[model samples]
Target chain A: MKMSGAQMICEAIIAEGIKTVFGYPGGAIMNVYDEIYKQNKFEHILTRHEQAAVHAADGYARASGEVGVAMVTSGPGFTNAVTGIATAYTDSIPLVVISGQVPLSLIGTDGFQEIDAVGISRSCTKHNYLVRTLEELPRVLKEAFYIARSGRPGPVLVDVPKDITGEIGEFFYPSEVNLPSYKPNYKGNNRQIHKAAKAILEAKKPLLYIGGGAVLSGAAEIVRELAWMTQIPAVETLMSRGVMGAKNPLLLGMLGMHGNYASNMAMSETDLVISLGARFDDRVTGKLSEFAKYADVIHVDIDPANIAKLVDVDYPIVGDIKTVVEKLIPLLKEEIRTERYQVWRDILGRYDELHPLLYNDSDEVIKPQWAIERLGELVGEQAIITSDVGQHQMWAAQFYPFDRPNQWINSGGLGTMGFGFPAAIGAKKAVPEKTVINITGDGSILMNVQELVTAAEHRIPVINVILNNHFLGMVRQWQTFFYDKRYSETDLSYQPNWKMLAEACGGIGYDVTTKEEFDAAIKDAIAQDKVAFVNVAIARLENVLPMVPSGGALYNMLLEHKEEK
Target chain B: MEAVRRVISVVVLNEAQVLARVSGLFAARGYNIESLTVAPIPETDMSRITIVTKGNKRVIEQITKQLHKLIPTFKVIEHEEMVEKELALIKFPIEESLSDIQVLCQAYNGGIANVGEKMVIGMVTDEPARVKHFIEAAKRYSPIEIVRGGVVAIER
Candidate 1:
């Protein structure tokens, strides 16, 4: 029964059914790392940086549907993990990050490598704790996990002082957490469900607005069924990429800036929007005053604060999306199904055909869209795709045929640049049998290029497909449009030889110029047993089109590029 | 739905950073907090925080929901029938008309609290709107310094 705080941490992790964690060791957290070294209960991935560790844990959580665990030491380590924590926080990913702090006696004296981490991360984290005593360690650990994986999941941080980890304690991990202030509603009210069902029955042109909350709550099957049963067309947000599946007939694709014409038009025309686990973010609501202007909204989310925060809702239901959808499913009669929405679907389908996502493909010089489409074809439904934020990310979202929940993982809210490679590594680790790929840009890949060595060391076999445009394509597109081609510091033409860089990092590398070479490189990369990087050269001046031009109405989209004097 | 002043009472666990967490949400979201008061509840390890802010019905609903979302917060009450009070202390020059100032303070349910050689300090506890009026009226006495406490509210 008597154990050191370090042992208690290990015991608690085991008790929580955590099989792996990601972290980088430091002076303050040495004792915990020592305990990690002694325990064989969980695997600890030693990342190149503290940031990547948290991101890898986030990816693991996203891919596995389990609460991710990560640890790092004080000061710089804690600060480095802030972006990853914020990224997970914004996306509602469940994560518990353990941060080692300075000794209790040396905390406020401005000792070496000491920062008010709990204070700094207070706003970003769902909840946080500064562990002062060894006795409360077990309970804190339990509550941290419980709060992280509960309703409207998010990242939680626990700052453990160095002295506390070294002190002896009696370890007792609680099976259940009982916080008087924290109880999440999981069931929808019957009357509200009835009201929503009635609204759906009356809505002739209803649209299903799906977001990451649906993905997080595992409401994909129910949502897809609801869309089909109700004959409602669906549109996905960036975070909810695969929830509606790429092949669904009712799916209008992503709806926002850079979203397809059909989806945006459908959003503009729909009479009712059933918002399942989706917050009406500014990006989704291009111009707030005109967004879904004629629509009655039924916003259902686990978080009460999200409902009507930006857009007013006619029917607001605060509960788990899956549970609420399940309750509402039984209320709908077969008579609710009719051909009333057929005309609406036809209108959207016509829009899709009129302004389809198009790009000119060349055999000599590979286009990013073509490359992503080819990659999607080669890596079918079985692969998990992660992408960094940029032109390539948008392309992947546009092209990848993700057919299931959690099949596509990316930083949606934070849009962290260096997210793809480490996330792919974590996804591969979570599901070793499945192939994992990071579709990255030349700029984003370099941000976390050091993690290539981590993947190589573990032989994670995560393929990094670089869409090498030699420039920040998204920013260049903006500069070309708004700034009159005054491209300031957006060019990365003078870059490292990626092949040599990958070779140096203990991974196989390929320099792909033509479409044939790109295809060959990807197939060969997947065939390899080690980490592989395929640097494919894409067209330099390509832009992600169908933009709303910031603060413009969603329906007012610039379909393609035009030369203007 | 027009912008109007609303008072909300939030009960939260007494912890080191609970106040920071509660206030940080408002600061981060650009929500306005006009006045805030915090004091521990008797015989319990909990504190009641009263916040007065200006928002429309939607914004006030969001603020209350956000406050309720905090892990340490136990209850958030936006009472329809409530009694609100604010305290204001004003220091006046000793040469001012003491009788007139005392009468004015009494009109606002208060009186002079201290008489020092250099100044006279008057205190008043009244409704927040009346407290505003009392401060404005005391300005005529050429007060040396004035301090106003945050509003605290309770359901009637």
Candidate 2:
């Protein structure tokens, strides 16, 4: 059927089964926006800024396991969305972003509101396209979704020229893509899977190092089952939380730079490390050469490049994490360990006791860790909690005790600040019945706090728990420990009355300085069926500890309060 | 293992600034591209990109694997067993003996592509190493200028 480029886009989006799209309209994208309005194929969310639109899409994708869609005008519009796109790129979230560019005639002439959108976003995107003619628009749009959601999922961009969106053309969506050289391995090699199973059974101490790929591939249940059947302990990276149940016996807490003592110790001491859908990022492996030195590493990821990028892999199973883990579960069932791991468990248990995840319980003042703990306790870790980067993010990742896959979402790779609130709104939209909360810091919150109006106006009721420490907590912590106390511009003392800011934005707000106030404020925010912000003033100078100093071994953990001499 | 220079050739859908995506991949990953060339393939909807880079076995494999990830990419050839040649053009004063230069170029499949009243242009088509050797060998002629193009290769 012949259709306008904009109409074809709407048709293709409907074909992809997309229910919602977040975007902001501009002159360049007016036609596509009009087509969307006419088709009524998607729930169009008008966000305050282009950046938030992408964040919302990314959050929705991560939380719902759907390919999230975001559209915006070209130039400044897509440039603003760069951070959000880069955030998804780093964490491997499946997202399709459609951006409108200047007309073909104006391209490269620096047309009004036109920058090289494709060029700017090329590196951060899994794949990107700039449609030249109407003939390619339908196929390009289809391929964008296919590329975004397949094979180690990441964000993909399709920049549509304004003229093409207005031009009429024949619309035909291909049933299948024939990317001969781009075929992704979803099924594991039988021989490698069996060898991994044998290695797991023979090893005296085996550790499952799961990452975000497991969550994206829907392999959390399989991962938990493998740990259960094999009686092997596992550790979750920042992105891999909630894969194992809180009560799962074979589970170690979050592992890496700011991870639990037992988890890092287990990673260092294990005989075999089975990495599931997780890249050996610098954060996870403190010092590449010494990381998991005692272990034979088996890496399982959909991306072959991730297998030995940072650390050597003894066995590489390049396939989808969920698929690989599902197949491994059966093979491992027959090869269950004959020897008990009680001794190994005992040592890790002792380590956990010796270096417990600690925070001074302060009744006189509010503690960031306490607030996160109380929030988790009140509404278990089952709620969808997204966090911005900083100490609060690390604290949430560590103390929340996540036990549900896809429930705990954050900007892990890019460590992007200003991502949480908008993302929480998106998550809430994705899973309306579930509670959605943005655990943020003063520094990170202010980055995109303007979105308060979007949440209030749109009735996207997402609660924001701001840890008001008046400083960039993570940077301050580093300076306090490493530097000679030359406190730079890390302080953010000058701030608005957060409660007033929320109230002015037509949202419920509360300022809590004590535990009682914090507890009550959280309850009030949850009970209120409206957008809410709870600003909890936490103790200043507090730090996230058990940090592996830069370039240090995995085992070299630094305590928050070091004993003198 | 020590790092060695490798030539990677990629065929991608001929599109706008696909070279940016091709070269950007290596730069973003901190993989150095010593030399790169791109031109449209005849009678096909594709362009061939040749990138000269230095890396160990693992790094080279990563470069090739990542190249396959780009959307426009249709094929990536690592040139493991291939006939490869890099062209270097030299401009020397007309005073230098054209016969002597031709003899040196003959060693590396060289020829005089252009001759002017003031200067003569000599061309060499050979393995990148031999081209470099020819350029060094022709230096005694005091060549005024040298221009080297990216490597182009075919399966052996």
Candidate 3:
């Protein structure tokens, strides 16, 4: 059947099993919006801002294990989607962003609402295409979906020129994409795999360093099995929080700049570091030469370029994480009672007991960590937690015990400021039956607070628990520790009344300033039939403890001192 | 043991300081590329680069990894189990050996043509490494000059 490019786009998304899309309509994309209205096949969520649309798509992708789709019009609409694209790119989320562009003939002449969407999104996206003709629409759509969901998943942009959307074409979705330039290697060399396995067998103290790629590749079960068989304690990066169930005895929590003291210490002393699906970010490895100095690193990643680029690896396996781990599982000989594993675990346990996370009663307002822990207790293992970046993000990483893969979504690599609100909307949309909550700080929420309208419009019923510390908590904490506590531009003054903000967005809102108030507010938010925001007024001076100061060793953490205040 | 050798063809952005970036990456990663050739695309703002490197499977994989990390590199393809070719034009002296050279060039997917008086140019285009071998073989005939084109590739 002959159809316009706009209609074909909706059809292609439907073919890929997409049931919903988040977007905001505008002039250049009115035709596409009209096509969407005519079919009424898929649900179109109207977000307050285009950024939220992209982020909601990202959240949907992470939760549902499918390509998240978002749409927007030209000019500012296209520009607003950039942050969301960058977030997806940094976290390696699968997103196919479709945006409307000005007419082809008027592209270079600065037509109405015309902007270089393709050029602006080039670096942030895995690949981008401008559909100038009806003939290119079908192939471009198919290729975008394929590239977005394939190896090392990331966002792909397809800018449909306004004139092309009106053109007619026989829409046929291709079953196979034959791009010679984009062949991703999914199998590691047998020799490299064997070498990695042999290194694991020979090492005295082996540690499994996990990251978001493990979850993306669906290698969690294999990773757990390998860790158990080898008796290696696994420490995850922030993005890899839920890849393995946190309750497992062999699991050490997230390790990095704001990671657990014990996990960092263990990483420092490990003799054999088996890193899976993780780039060696600066936060994870303090100094390249000093990182895992005593270890023979075995780096396994799907992207060959990342291997040995940052840190030297004795054994590098480039392939799908799950495939590589599954292959190596059989090759490794089961050594049940390795003394090294026991000794390392014992040391970690000692550190955990000595400097446990503390939040004793004080005259000040409610503590943010207390609120997070209380929420964890109320929600238990099933609740899906999404967080914005800051002290609250780190606290959630520490306090929440995620027991399933993809249960926790946060901006780990990029640390994007306003990720929580929109991400929560996407997560709730992806899994409507599951209870989804956005744990964000007051400072971070303002970055994309308009997304509350998205939740209200879609009736997603996401619980937004704002830890209102009245300051850019992470930066303040840094100034307190590293600098002389000058509080330079860290204080957020003239804050909006969150209750009023939530109510303005057509959602339930509550402000809690004490532990009792916090508990009641959380319970009430979860019970509310619509989107709810519970603002817990936390102590502004409070800091996220167990922090490793800049250039400091993991073992030399500056633990929180009650006497200092 | 005899060293294993392979020729790699790379398509990259043609701009100032791109060659330095590509070659610097290889040098920093300790990859010893034997023969390197680079030139601009005839009708576009892109360049084609051909590199000859010797190594086993592991070393080749390392070289490819380093090459892929270069920002200017558009694509990298190692000529293994693919149709590969290179072209060269050698200006030779007009002599009785012209007919013999023509027969040799034809055997390797090439032909000899007389361009001007006392100067006959023989051209041969084959697999890049094979072309290198041909150039060395033709050196015995006292060829006056030789110019080789950078390699280009297409997946089979």
Better of 1 and 3 by DockQ: 1
Task: Kindly report which residue stretches of model 3 are placed more than 4 angstroms away from their true locations once superposed.
Answer: A333-340, A361-364, A563-565, B1-9, B12-156
Q: Which stretches of candidate 1 lie over 4 Å from their true place?
A: A561-565
For each candidate, the DockQ is 0.88, 0.67, 0.13
In the range A223-244, model 2's lDDT, one tens digit per residue, is: 8887877778889999988989
Q: Summarize candidate 3's per-residue lDDT along A421-448 as a digit string, tens digits.
A: 8888888888888889999988999988
- lDDT (10s digit) by residue, model 1, range A171-270: 7889999899999998977799899999998998899999999999999999988887887899999989999888898898999988999999888988
Better of 1 and 2 by lDDT: 1
Error of 3 at A558 (Å): 1.6
Arranged by TM-score, best first: 1, 2, 3
Question: Considering DockQ, where higher is better, how would the candidates rank from best to worst?
Answer: 1, 2, 3
Write out the backbone clash pairs for model 1. none
Error of 2 at A525 (Å): 1.3
TM-score of 3: 0.82
Best by DockQ: 1
Rate residue A507 of model 1 by lDDT: 98
